[model samples]
Target chain A: MTRLIDVENLTLRFSTDEGMITAVDNVSFSLEAGEVMGLVGESGSGKSVTAKSLMKLNASNASYSDETKITLHLDDGPVNVMDLKTSKDMKVVRGGAISMIFQEPMASFAPAITIGDQMVEQLQIHTDMNSKQAREVSIEMLDRVGISDAAQRFKQYAFELSGGMRQRAMIAMALSTKPKLLIADEPTTALDVTIQAQVIDLMKDLVKEFGMGIIFITHDLGVIAQTADKVAVMYLGRLVEQGAVRDVIRNPAHPYTRGLLAALPQLDDLEKPLVPIPGDIPSPLERPPGCVFNTRCEEKVGDICSAKVPDFTNVTENHRAACHIYTQGSDK
Target chain B: MSDDVLISARDLSVHYPLAKGGLFGPKPVVKAVEGVNLDIAKGSFFGLVGESGSGKTTLGRACLKAAPITRGTVRYTDGDVDYSLTEIDNTQLKDYRTRSQLIFQDPYAALSPRMTVRDIIAEPLEVMGLTNGREETDERVREIAAKCRLNLEHLRRFPHAFSGGQRQRISIARALVSRPRFVVADESVAALDVSIQADVLNLLRDIQQEMGLTFLFISHDLSVVAHVCDHVAVMYLGRLVETAPTKDLFKAPRHPYTKALLSAIPSLDPDDPNKAQKLEGEIPSPTNPPPGCKFQTRCPFAVDKCRVDEPKLEHSSTDHVVACHRWQELME
Candidate 1:
């Protein structure tokens, strides 16, 4: 698999009224063509910030560390995303090379404009397609995403369509540009179980057909398990674990990862009692000194967990976790 | 109806007048919920699952008497009191408020941002005059807050100081503070992260057991429903299609809609084959739903009979009920 994007030592902070809040703390990950990377985290976990950083879409208040590097490898050459300061230069990273589908389809789409018009607008901005060509391509993409009577739907506004159709339309608009990377941020969270299943299937199919790298951001482990080739678990702005989805789900090394899986309501076995992490996630302003998740981690290693941050320990060939337990195990 | 049924509805319908009416023409009605019959056993967690526009929310609101019921009857029966919701006066309605309550989906929007957690939880007790004084209200709020796993100190702080899970707990605390025998939790945990969702689910189950409260748990997620609910009902386009015990519903769903719904949930096991019976179209518009079975438009097994004749709920077993013209034949 060819590398599509690489992020290294990406530390980001937001200057809030309260204080400087660390949103993404020294996170690093890479993606390859046609691969799906699941960035799993709850609110304030910095999963969204990490994904948004690819296109430099963070708020104006956000400040990144000087050592942080984000390199988007296009067909032409590798370009540092952080260096793209102007809108003209950033366009290559924004919708040109990377497209994003948000959780709320209504917000993403222009309610006043026809679905086709907005899609055409996006394609025009990203590609050299004329109005006619853009409309044709938009309708085709809409049909590809499973919208019945695509031609009729092309003339309809976002509100005219159902929630599922609106989401499908948004996906169609995103993929119509033929971008290399697609960042889907909780795309199916607003959808029903059945519609979500459809959308997930459509995304999987699109990935195979387009041969594009996808970053699937969601808190649902089941979605991650089914859709993601690789998984990264985030807790309180830190990447606690990263590995192949199978490995991470089967044998989670990080205590937080284990706790997350345990907390999920298992459909296969209904008798299992849900075990939530003992304590609440600490506020980002009051982030713990050592391991970010130590406040909620079940298998805390006493002083070591709260005193110093643990380095990543390789649990398997491609699986790694940053935890005192794994580090201690390796030392022994 | 069983003696243990705390709430029962027969042919319940909730219709809203649309603004599309002209000066002279008859006002068009948006049948948010139509021809729905349900029975909630005392101290049981009943799950209601459906897609958007499927009327789950409106149905829940109707049970709470929040939505105006246009037709049929709803009965609230406890040990001694038997009040018909449709025939209840102002005094009876006020008393019913103490016997039943609603937990909203969005914690952020549901709780007053300006008020502290204590005041938010205490509002219900004060509004309904459930407590004699501020001290009594505080005592009840503290008791319920503890049951929801909220710290006493945290109650002094505003809702903005808390996370989504904690805020949801506050909402739960507020809902249960009135000591209602029947509670309608409308997608209460949908807004929370999966990890936190489990915590709230466990808390709800624990509280239900302790308080002996019957919950009408409304959600669009099938897995969550299967995990928390003892029995489940499937709704589509303002109609009830199926009702059964959770295990039986999951094991062998008779309605095509139910079967499709079960299959659509992305399984934790990646190897699990995607359901072969993938539903095709979006749910038809509720205002102008196709005459007959609303699910027929998307059902793979839909026939001429299904297209013209609406199917009513029929019992397949002692506890299982389904609405499908060909359920018996299709099951074979």
Candidate 2:
């Protein structure tokens, strides 16, 4: 199992009008080939930011910490993605080794260009394929994604297709380059459930066939539970919990994780009252002194929780959570 | 099950004329809601579930008289007053506005940026002339804001100062300020984070209970629908495909579309082993819907009969209706 991507101590901030606001604080995660890691969080939790950071897609105002490091392990060699200063150097991360699909497929696809043309362009840029070859491969990719009349669809603009088809086309374009990793940023959020199901299944099958690692960023736990091999729970720009999807979901350690699970309206159990974590998520500018989630955490562990950030504590063999409850009386 | 029907919509249809007339003599129409029938019990949290172009939003809007009703009789009877929404005049419509309110989907866009939370909430009361004076308006605003868990100090601030969840709470407060008996929440929690969605949902449920209101909760998320709604109706291509109690619908769905929808929800349990029976193809175009059963194109059990003759909603059991020629056989 080769490491596809490894991000360490990724502290990111933006120079906004309000002040320097930290978006991703000391986050760390790695992806293995053919494994799917689900990044689950609410709005402003920076799940999307973390995914974007992988491809250096954050805006110009964004700043990275000195200790931050992003290593992309490709077939050729390991490349320090964070060190890539030029757009040409960054291209290897963008469409060569990694590809991304956004929530809005319509926004991703050009209204003027046909879906086939865009996919062909992606293939031509990443691979040594000619115009004719790219067109054949694009049509094949379109067909592979369950699109009927692929040739006919090849000539149709994005607006001509339905929402589900547009998403499928987006997926086709993203995967056409045969990248080693895929970052799907809420790819199905805008879609209907039935269509989302089909897309999820398609991505899963594609992962198996392509042997590509995927970082699936979404707020929907059900989608994460079904698709992800591992799950990472984020809150206020920090990774609160990281573990196997089953362990993390079944026996969550972090209070935030517990609160999230409790908040969800689970179909398996309808009798449980939805208990939202009290208090609003504190603004980034007015961030709590210590643990980012201390403002809303129900099980506050005295002054230490408010004084110092809790380090990650192992809950089980493959599960870990950042919480003061697990660190009580531990040596400094 | 009870004869306490607050709203009974019979043969409800909403049609929008196209800008350009079709090749034929008659102008082409977009049948947003075609031949829909529903009975919403008083004080019931009725869920309307559908994907894009399924007409759930249009149906909800029609109930509120926000969308034009081409043909139908929407009988609104709340013990105090009885009026046909479709045939209501200007005065009746104005009165209906006070009794029936709509909570929009986007919290960010729903609130006017220029107005303070207090003013935003009080606007409905003022516009309807429900409040006699400034003190009365303030009193009502403060009361509803408190119910929505908003603080008095917070009410003085603009919506831009609030978070997505907080803004949604404000939206809820604004909608409930007039003390409307019938509330239409169209994807109200869809914009919020998963954790915040639960908070807003709990708030909606609490308000409903406290005020004894009837809610037409329109959404695309089945899991969320299963949680909050007492009775759920499934829509496809502007037609009601199935209707049942929430638990009954999730437990034993009869219609193929209903069953497919239930299965399509990505299960929270990772090792459930129940492979999602993914529906094939996109939902057929609403502009030119498929003949007969709307779901026939994507339904695995679709037959020639399903493609030629539209199936009317038929009862399977008490309070459980399904529209499918082979629902009985499919259930077995």
Top TM-score prediction, candidate number? 2
All models, DockQ values?
0.72, 0.80
Most accurate candidate by DockQ? 2
lDDT of 1 at B200: 92
Best by lDDT: 1
- Model 2, B1-332: lDDT tens per residue? 34599999999999999889868798878888899989999989999998888899999999988899999789999777889987788888888888998999998888899999989999988888887899989998999988999988888899999888899999888888888889999999888777788889998998899889999999988888988999999999899999999999999988888877888888889987446476777777677898988888888988899999999988999899988999878766
- The sequence of per-residue lDDT tens digits that candidate 1 reaches over residues A1-332 is 89999999999999999999999999999999999999998877998999998898999999999989999899899999989899999999899899999999999888799998898898888889899999999999999998999999999999988889999999998999899999999999888777888899899999999999999999888899899999999998889999999999999889998998898887788888888887678888899999988888778877999999989989989999999997777677
CA deviation > 4 Å runs, candidate 2 = A329-332
Candidate 1 lDDT tens digits, B132-165:
8889888988898998889998888999988888
User: How would you encode candidate 2's per-residue C-alpha lDDT over A161-268 as one tens digit per residue?
Assistant: 988899998999898899999999999999988888889989989999999999999988899999999999999899999999999999999999999989988878
Scoring model 2 with DockQ, what do you get?
0.80
Cα displacement (angstroms), candidate 2, residue A171, comes to: 1.5
Candidate 2 scores an iRMS of 1.2
TM-score for each candidate, following the candidate numbering? 0.96, 0.97
